[model samples]
Target: MLLADVVATSAALAATRSRKSKIAALAELLTRAGPGELPAVVAFLTGQPTQGRIGAGWRTLAELGAAPAGAPELTVAQVDAALGEVASASGSGSAQRRTVALRGLFARATQDEQRFLFRLLTGELRQGALEGVMVDAIATAAAVPGEVVRRAFMLSGRLPVTASAAVTGGERALGEFRLALGRPIRPMLASPAESLEEAIAEHASAIVEYKMDGARIQVHREGDEVHVYTRTLREITGSVGELVELVRALPCRSVVLDGETLALSDDGRPRPFQETMSRFGSTRDEQVRALLLRPYFFDCLHLDGEDLLDAPLRERNNALRTVAGAHLIPGESEPGAPAEILESALEAGHEGVMVKSLDSPYAAGRRGRAWLKVKPVHTLDLVVLAAEWGHGRRTGYLSNLHLGARDPDGGPPIMVGKTFKGLTDELLAWQTKTFPELETRRDDWTVYLRPELVVEIELDGAQVSTRYPGGVALRFARVVRYRPDKQAHDADTIDAVRATLKG
Candidate 1:
């Protein structure tokens, strides 16, 4: 297929607010894609290239003075191959080679295609082709059930791969996707709860566990080989040797364990989140050894060649107990009152309590009500839309932050409010240096940025307001931390913020 067709469909998707229209357009486009071109088509439509992060930044792209072609002759396969060359260029003079490759690619693309490629490469393509919508479109195009597509995606951990399979062999191919060892699946997510009592009341039998303020890790062990993946499914096996060793020591021959990992102080309290995250980047073996990450397994997805993903939490926990043993997270099943559990978790320097339904299966990649996370303070993962120049003691620094909530319908992030609170001197220095790099444009007072950075904000609550586009504003909002592990799409949605108004 021609690249122009994909670009035109992307424009059509961005022009409409109706999700049904977007799905229909995407489905039509998918149907036209050849079996071999399906992967690239699906990936490009989602605003991400098959070759992730080809090292081309805004500055590099801007420096490429390639003039657009008059007509569109670039094929999807041709563009994909060009990007592959660019991504593979990585030696001493790789920068120049990458520039040459990108320039050549852009020189052949028309104005419309160039614009689409630029946005797609820069992670700025926000045309509502979210994973969920894409899954639906793939199912529609392949004449398969949406649930089948979704399940395949969740298990395979790649929408493009799932799209290829669905298009080639339909539901039968999707069924081939299973819980494979050494391959990371999307971790099951939980929704934020209003309160512990409310969460407990919603489920007949609940397992209340401590909600740790740490990174999520999914460990897959096959015999002696163990692989650790982040919440986003990125492998960090080499960076976390201690975690691999711990998982390898498990009695089970093969297993997939889902849990949290963090560094702890001598007194057993969790260390600062940044300190724990630092281990993921540490290249020195001594540094990693000094700050060991402790694993707290909560769910056992697979054990002894048996898949427990379809089993209820009760059965899964039983399997987890058998394998995890001492490594299991502290939690009470069918507790009389979860209020004490919540209080104990808070006092232990943890985030709060997670109230989970005992009967729910592991619905990977979906944030359903089966698991509810209750924290003492309200926190929302919001995107940094813009930052204003500081005044007084904070002069020259980008201090006040304009935060936005993710639009669930796949539109641009909606500005909710601004806050300069909870920023330390170090944070201020970092922001001054970082925000400019991410700046899309700037005025005299404020610098607008791409909606990429995800910052966790602690607020008293939310209130109905018309000042912001989302019709809700945060109350006494302050920055808790910058969540580097999350992306803009992973930020809390506007609907979630508006729901806070009920509090």
Candidate 2:
């Protein structure tokens, strides 16, 4: 299909706030696409190249110039056929050229097609639709069930393969694959829980473990070789050579361990989260190597040749304990009361507790009831001082927020912190439409708003900082919810925050 055709659908999806409308547009594109073009379709729709995450990226617009003269006319099917040809092409030059050639060919198509191609390649269709939604669309277009496609994705760890199979033999044939390792599948995540009591009441006796302040990392090992990737699956193996070497020396031939990497003191207590995060986003191998790290394995997803994702948490934990050996994070029976657990965690200077369901299996990528985090609640009523325009999916929405607390002894309320976390799309849209009226002036992306809206901000804890106008600000602050019940004058005082810091 023409690139313009794809762009039109994307534009339609982008224009609409309705989820069903976006799905319908995506479904139409899947129907128009040929089998061979499935990779490009997937790539375009997902806003990524057909090449996986590790593949070379399209760096510049010039790299995607006009198609060559006298080249055979490319069709949608021809695009699909090129997948293997491009995959097999050797050397960096060939790869670069092929990427350019493919892009140029698509560029030769209509403006609408270019829009679709851009959106697809960039993967931010931004209509509240995600991978799961698109998978269903592909299945629908191919006369198959969504589960069939999802199963293929679960096994192959590649959406292009799943799409090709769905477009060819339908979902039934796609379901015939099994899970494997070395290939990184989606990591399991947890849905946000309201409270500890709510989680325990729902779970009925959950296995609560300490939620340490750290980065989530998954280590894939075989014999004396190890590959470590983050929760986002970014290859960070070169960063922590010591940890890699430690995993390589483990007795197991093949193992996939889920864990956290933290900077801990000699007493086994974790340091401030920023101390660990400071080492991240750095490119220097030596700098990353200098980072103090301790890998605390929590769950065993794979051992030897078997996939342990199917096993219950208790069983997986037992296997993880045996296989992880010295690297395992010690988890004990949860204390009866939340206060006790909180005190213990605080006394150790760690984060809070992570409650995991014993009977639950590893549900990769989906934040189900398998795991839930319970941190100590620190609530502060703060005023919304400024707001910034959101990006990507939240384009045209006011998403970035700056909050402040009262300073009765001062000239102005002290700027506590800014947050873009814990906000729903509804909230983003509401702020986008509402914040402009309350704006003082506009910058490139932010609206400087009067501090009239008081919000109750909750945080992990307070840490000393120079970022905020206040000497101290909320650390890891997120919105508990709008404090409509409280007025701006009634916001929490800096003295109260200072008291917490003293504690």
Candidate 3:
């Protein structure tokens, strides 16, 4: 299939506002693609690359002609040349030369085809569809259960591998497969629930655990060796060497754990989520060294040659505790007891609680009702210091709002954090219309909101920081609503913040 064809379909899908239309468009494309090409095609349609800085499309086309074994010598210049050729041609050439020749071949495409080609090559085909939707389409096209794709994704460590396996071996094969390392699995994530009681009622047999104010991380270990990856599956091994060392010291060897890694205070409390987020993709070894991180193991997907993902949550928690010892997140109990656990977790200074269905098997890349999160609604009076214009669908709105708490010693209201989440459409429209009037200055990207407006804000937690003027940062800070009744003088002070940090 031509790259332009895929890009055009992706663009059409992106333009459709209805999700079903987007899925239908993607399904049609999936039915037409070669089995081996489906993964790259799905990745392209979602505006994501399978691997490396280059498009998987280039690699997919090259493989069509059967490239030689061994890591083929590839360079930046070669990738550039191949991408350009693929843009214009029918993507046909000797396997060895296809990628390198794509650059020249791409130039032969028609104007509309060229536009699609550019989108494909740049991996910017931002259709509403994501990996989950593609998984469903692939399952439908391949005549396999969606769970087959999910299991294959978990065991094989890559969705494309799972897709290829499903295409070749059928659904039964995927259900029997096991996990291996250096491989990626579709990560499991949680969706917010209406309430903890509601979540418990929905998941009758769930394991309730503390939800820390931290960054999600997956750790891969082989004997004494360990590697850390972010939720995005980007390997950040070098940045968290201390945690890696800690993982290596665990009683069990050859373990792969799914958990959260966050900067911790001297007393072992998690730092604000933002501080932990900043550690991601960081280049400074000194900064990495200075930050004290604790790896809180919540679940064990794989350990000691057995795939624990299919085991009940209680079973998985047992295995986790045996292998991880103190690293295992405390409170592995039934959903019926979550309220008690929630109280304990809160008293321990955790953000709230994460409830997981006990009988739920790991669903890679799927946000099913298997896992849910509940948080305390903590509100504080804060000042708005700055705001940034939103992008994509939110382009015209002042979306990213910088927030600050009062400094009792008296200086500027120091920036604690910024957020675009938790804003309703009505609030977004109101901000769009009103923030301009409050702007102290305007730049192309941001408008500085006058600190005169005191707004009640809510957050997950506070942590020590080097970025903010107050030497603190907020976790998941969002505007609750304008505190019109409160003045700037009534805003919570840094002393109150310091007390929260100390507590």
The backbone clash count of each candidate, in order, is 0, 15, 17
Best by TM-score: 1
Question: Model 3 misses residue 357 by how many Å?
Answer: 2.3
Best candidate, lDDT-wise?
1
Residue 428 alpha-carbon offset, candidate 3, angstroms: 19
Lowest lDDT sum, 10 consecutive residues, model 2, at 53-62
Assess each prediction's global lDDT (C-alpha) against the native: 0.90, 0.67, 0.67
Candidate 2, residues 1-503, lDDT tens digits: the string is 74445556656655765656666777778777777666676655554456543232334323466544332234544544444455466775886766755565565555445444433333223333346656777777778877667667765667777877888787567866665555666667664455677766667556766677677888888777788877656667877777888888887889988888888767777865546655555555665447678888988988888878778888998888888887876556454765566568767876577778888877653446668766666566788878888789988888878887765421235787889888887678778887765565578977876556777677876778887767886778887566443345456667656655634
lDDT (tens digit, per residue) of candidate 3 on 266-298: 786666554675566555667656777887889
Which portions of model 3 miss their true places by more than 4 Å?
15-24, 35-39, 49-52, 55-81, 84-106, 121-123, 172-177, 285-287, 332-337, 378-503
Per-model TM-score versus the true fold: 0.97, 0.66, 0.65
Query: Where in model 2 is the C-alpha error above 4 Å?
Result: 52-107, 117-128, 142-148, 272-282, 285-287, 333-339, 378-503
Q: How many backbone clashes does candidate 1 have?
A: 0
